[model samples]
Target: MMSDVFLRIENLRKEFGATPVVNGLDLDIKQGEFVSLLGASGCGKTTTLQMIAGFEKPTSGRIWLNGKDITDVPPSKREIGIVFQNYALFPHMTVEENILFGLVLRKVDKAAQRKRLSELLDLVHLVGLEARYPRELSGGQQQRVAIARALAIKPNVLLLDEPFSNLDARLRADMQNEVKRLQIETGITTILVTHDQAEAMALSDRLAIMHKGVALQVDTPQATYDHPASRYVGNFLGNINILQADLRDVGSHVSFSANGKSLQVLNDQRLSPERCCISIRPERVRIQPQPTDCEVLLGATVTSKNYNGNSWDIGTETELGSVNINIPHHGAPTPDRGQSIVVGWNLNDMRLVHVD
Candidate 1:
């Protein structure tokens, strides 16, 4: 059976005054899929979400939900649920009231409303807290109530805008897992707008990394981190060590010459014989006290070491440039500062990116 597309956005453009926020964007989201629009501030992720929710009108383009054109639909008529960062729960309303507000407004019967309220409360793990007001709940609990309220109408699409941004680090991680769990249980199409890369990676089946109102890359979180499409995407996704090297005159087996050392390119098709940038993750780099018989080696001086509980972040000043390396702590002796070390990486580990 072919799974149908749940949402389709074509040439979606949004503008604020004279500036374009979402510039000619196109996207397709599959049913029961969790897609996140990730970018920094002013990247128009929130604008795209708002347009889908009918909170903002697009300057141009079309939005289709299950083959129905909803470009001109009002917010209340869209049948889309939205959860905001601040929870947006009414301060004076109890949790049950908040969850039942939409049903009540729609003139649902008292019996049916009560049944749906119980199910929603239990779904969000707030069954016993229905009588509690927003003031009586913690940040995470309040957010759960907000989620329950959004799901009360049984929306076909759920939109979350920085849903866990208000929680602390630990609570944020916990909620990420909770949201993923609930998404699996409901099988509703979900779109999350977030500026945090970790949050996007944790929850998104596929993520769109936006930049300046354009999507630079749309792929799975692991793919985006492992094989970024551009240098900008590589830098934004995670910690990368970029080295400048001349690739001119290099043959099928391209070699990167830097710091008086040469590194062979295993995948020659990915490199060009011109100005190029080599990006490697910190975890891909291996540091040793002495150079091995490897074809490529670089000397670096350990500048600082930071212990991050599970791993150590080692900063080094290499002849090529300053680089950061992450090493897992498994009872291995920590390298001291001022120690000279040789850092090695396989050719396959390096991603050759064109530098313009």
Candidate 2:
């Protein structure tokens, strides 16, 4: 599908009063690709979405949609559907009226409009609530109405700006499932802008990690979490334990040593052997009372242990360094504080990460 580039942003840049919000960002989205622009607040994710929606002008760049440049296209002509964070439904309008508003503006034939309205209501599971005003609906129902309104015109691409932020935790999760279902059924090229890591990972086929007005890395959600290109991206996605060590190249392999403990790593010719920092996920580490067969094993004493619902987060002090291990809490006895334990992990779990 690499040949089917449906949306492209070339060197996109936006500046307000000399402060650049988005700078030199280039991204290619395949047809039917679901991509999320992810980052913290003020990281320019929303600004980037605004530019793509043609609501904000880029200071310098080009946006291509379906093989044509749309940088200067008006929002009305772009055929893009947007679902805002606040679910911007008309207060006085009924759900049916809100959904039909777009079709009415496009002057769709009455018969066709009725058919689409019926289908959308069913698509979003709002069959019997069509006559209810926005005030009469729950937050989730209101969100469904917003989505139905956006999709009524059959847009080429869909943009969602933190669409679940206003809902409660359970409702937010339900809405996420609904949006994913809609995207799969409609096959619309979708772009979601969100600051929530879990939401972005759950909904996106590809995630773009943005920081300081630029995208640090764009990859699948799992790949991004497993092999983050930088420390910031790694820590942002999940819990990561970073170790500083001296790197030694051993012919076709590399060894990282710190405080008399060493771990062998696969030789990646792409990376220089002199790198000093490597990272591993806390969950990748295993804790046992006795040493097991592993690429790296260290004896440590538990300094603290906290029991989460599904896992025990144990902090320990070892010869290698201060290490944290997350073990499942499935009826197994957890190690007590000051108790000796062994920590082990595979070499492949440790990834070379940017020190910064």
Candidate 3:
């Protein structure tokens, strides 16, 4: 069964003069779902967010929020909350006062406002620091204040625009977990825009990969990573090994041949033999002392090795090409540079994709 959509963007197109920023983009966000618009800079992720927030009007398209058209609605009347990258908290206002500003503008009573303020403070875990101003708070604390203020309005939809870009690596991880927890607790329909692939994958229920003003692919994070729609998405998500090979249709499988070496791979789908590429993740490749107990094995010499705490990122030169692998540092003896070894992988790990 499909989830009920709370927000829909239909044929959304935004242009500044002649250059199109968002081109015919369509997205349906289910209620209580967390979706992230992910891409590099100038990919139209920010433009899409701004159009949804009513900060920038779309050149041609329609936006529906909870069954009502809001394409031309003013930002103040949209009932949507936004947390900017800068945390955008009022400099002069205290934490509590900043959170209460929206409520006060709507003429909410003082007693009710105080009660909500207490709840928000507890929700964001900033109870004792309510009296402190934004200038006095740390970066993480200021972000929490922004979240509290956004949630205080009880918005129908929440938008986060690179909300963690300002924090350091450690704080960014902490805030990612915090944001995921809060989204589950509140069940607010949230859309986040960010260029960080790991951060988007960590927090989003579904991720839309944008490129050159178009959404290239949209799916679960693992699905997009494992089965990318195009070469660009495959390269963007993580480290992958690409092979230029000539594919031949053998009885029940396909044979990928390159540099006088042939690798037998199972045929999962019909693929064009003329122009195709094989992609495999580094972690899927196994290294052994010699050629033993493997379907496809290649003799290689270790070129480089980098220890990353628990795993070793190894680079090897083989008959096919230079391939990289990530392996457990403790299980096997660490292969040193200038050492000979055999590399093998299961046929299912290799994917036949179009040549980009």
Best by lDDT: 2
Per-residue lDDT tens digits for candidate 1, residues 109-224, read 99999999988888999978999999999998998998889999999899999999888999999999989999999998999999898899989999998988888889999989
Which window of ten consecutive residues has the lowest lDDT sum in model 1?
266-275
What is the lDDT for 142 in model 1? 95
Model 3: lDDT to the true structure: 0.88
Off by over 4 Å in 3: 1-3, 249-254, 258-271
> What digit string (tens of lDDT, one per residue) describes model 2 on residues 181-218?
99999999999999999999999999999998889999
In terms of TM-score, which candidate is strongest?
2
Q: What ranking emerges by TM-score with the best candidate at the front?
A: 2, 3, 1
CA lDDT of each prediction against the hidden true structure = 0.86, 0.89, 0.88
Model 3 is weakest, by summed lDDT over 10 consecutive residues, at 266-275
- Model 2: which residue pairs collide? none
Q: List the residue pairs that clash in candidate 3.
A: none
Relative to the true structure, candidate 2 reaches a TM of 0.95
Once model 2 is optimally superposed onto the true structure by TM-score, how far is the C-alpha of residue 241 displaced, in angstroms?
0.6
- Stronger candidate by lDDT (1 vs 2): 2
Give the least accurate 10-residue stretch of model 2, judged by summed lDDT: 267-276
